[model samples]
Target: MLVEDEHSLHAINVGRRLLVQLIETCKELENIHRIYAYVESTNLDGIHFYTMMGFQRRETLPDYFPQRASLTPDAVKLVYEIGNDSSTEAIQTFPVTNQP
Candidate 1:
């Protein structure tokens, strides 16, 4: 799971870099074939952000979100295929310079 503080003041690229590094790391793992993220349909920013990060919209799950008194919404399933990429295999390690 990935999350960021809403009140964070870090540079935008910082999040992108971290997410890229996560994908790279997942690609290196032998058992991990793909990365999946579930986003609420009402969350346009999240939908756009994951889409921009090479995740493809695969399916729309109806009533995926819990039904609350206030609101309920469908969920968008996004997936990133990390297996069988020769390029990602070369990157075995990355330095940890920042903590969030």
Candidate 2:
């Protein structure tokens, strides 16, 4: 889920497309129920992006990245529950702009 900084892929909806495809593909599987990700607490932009993509904040994970010597070592857990009809319907209605 990493994109090169030089490319500026965010402006073109790359992340949105990837998440949509992932949800769509996972929805077809009977066992898949939710998609979750841990983002550094200091990463405000990352948090905003995921929230905008329909993920909800689950909890704050303390010492999530012990190896990293950062000011904010805690991580925020985000989850997108795809097991219910309402969640799927929300995904289907997400706005995605087609960029050439």
- Residue 7 of model 1 has an lDDT of 33
lDDT of 1 by residue, 1-100 (tens): 5455243634566657777988988867876667777776666666777789998888987887666554335777887777655333322221111122
Error of 2 at 84 (Å): 5.6
Query: RMSD to native for every prediction?
Result: 8.0, 8.1
Task: Tell me how many clashing residue pairs each candidate has.
Answer: 0, 0
Candidate achieving the largest TM-score: 2
Tell me the deviation in Å of residue 95 in model 2.
Answer: 25
Worst 10 residues of 1 by lDDT: 91-100
Question: Per-residue CA lDDT of candidate 2, range 1-100, in tens?
Answer: 4433223776788777878898888789766677776777877777787899888988988876655443466778888888745433322222111112
Error of 1 at 24 (Å): 0.8
| Full-model lDDT for every candidate | 0.64, 0.66
